[model samples]
Target: MDDTPTTTRPPRWLNDHEMRAWLGYRRMRALLDLQLARRLAADQGLSEPDYDVLTSLSDAEDHRIRLSELADRMLWSKSRLSHHVTRMQQRGLVTRQECASDGRGAFIVLTNHGMATLHAAAPDHVAAVREHFIDLLTEDQLRILGDLTDTVLAHLREQPA
Candidate 1:
């Protein structure tokens, strides 16, 4: 006969509705990411990471931003960003300029080639977004989803990295 004493409470678990909702969200996120990456690669000859870097540069003022800032914006480590930037530089998509003020710092400037590539890719990328995501939802659903995303983003930002 076993005579072990237990004082632990059962763990709180998701109920049926919550479980369904959570699983749906996970499935949707995964599928959307995969589809978007595949579309970017197949249609634009750019990997999702490459597209991300290019878009970030395109959005920055003067089509340039400090290398550290770029890494922060992309949530990539310094080493990873540096390696990717090196690859891009080799392709003539971007150039690394030494910061005049800070000898140790560098700026990532999108080149004409990069700008042209982004311009060419933008139309198809927009179409893919519309086809796979935007058109799938009603206006009200889109608004609600945006609000939900903002809320979640706020919560996430409040947490420690």
Candidate 2:
């Protein structure tokens, strides 16, 4: 081992094999996202964020959920959710309500227009998902992936930033 005084900074280390694996993961994810985004944009005029909100609302009871809950589900900060919601509200896609239980608590309510948009978007979104991602994976692979992702997500959630 040559004792060249390396800088005090910790070296960022990854073996050649590890680096290739990581690069492959990143490239596939980016490419898939790009393809999905383009398909959605062309077919439904839904941005990824817009689709996220729509899907979150669609999965909630009565197609409505609390604003903070929506933010959590979208993995978005409250301010970012607020800004997006404000724009959606302007488009008559959603509305906000003061929670009856808590004066400070607010709920994000999906309007009829929002539901309509989601319905219209669903087919193309599924087709895109199937074509670009799902169709490539076996059912077993999909299940294993879901399990692995959930495990990783749990670990990340437990770590303090």
Q: Summarize candidate 1's per-residue lDDT along 1-161 as a digit string, tens digits.
A: 77998689898999999999899999988998888888888887787778888999999999999999989888999889999999988888899999999999999999999999888888988898899899999999999999999999999999997
RMSD of candidates 1 onward, in order: 3.7, 4.4
> Model 2 over residues 92-153: C-alpha lDDT tens digits?
88899999999987888889999999899899899989998899999999999899899989
Name the weakest run of 10 consecutive residues (lDDT summed) in model 2: 3-12
- Top model number, lDDT: 1
Q: Which runs of model 2 end up more than 4 angstroms from their true locations?
A: 1-12
Misplaced by over 4 Å in model 1 are: 1-10
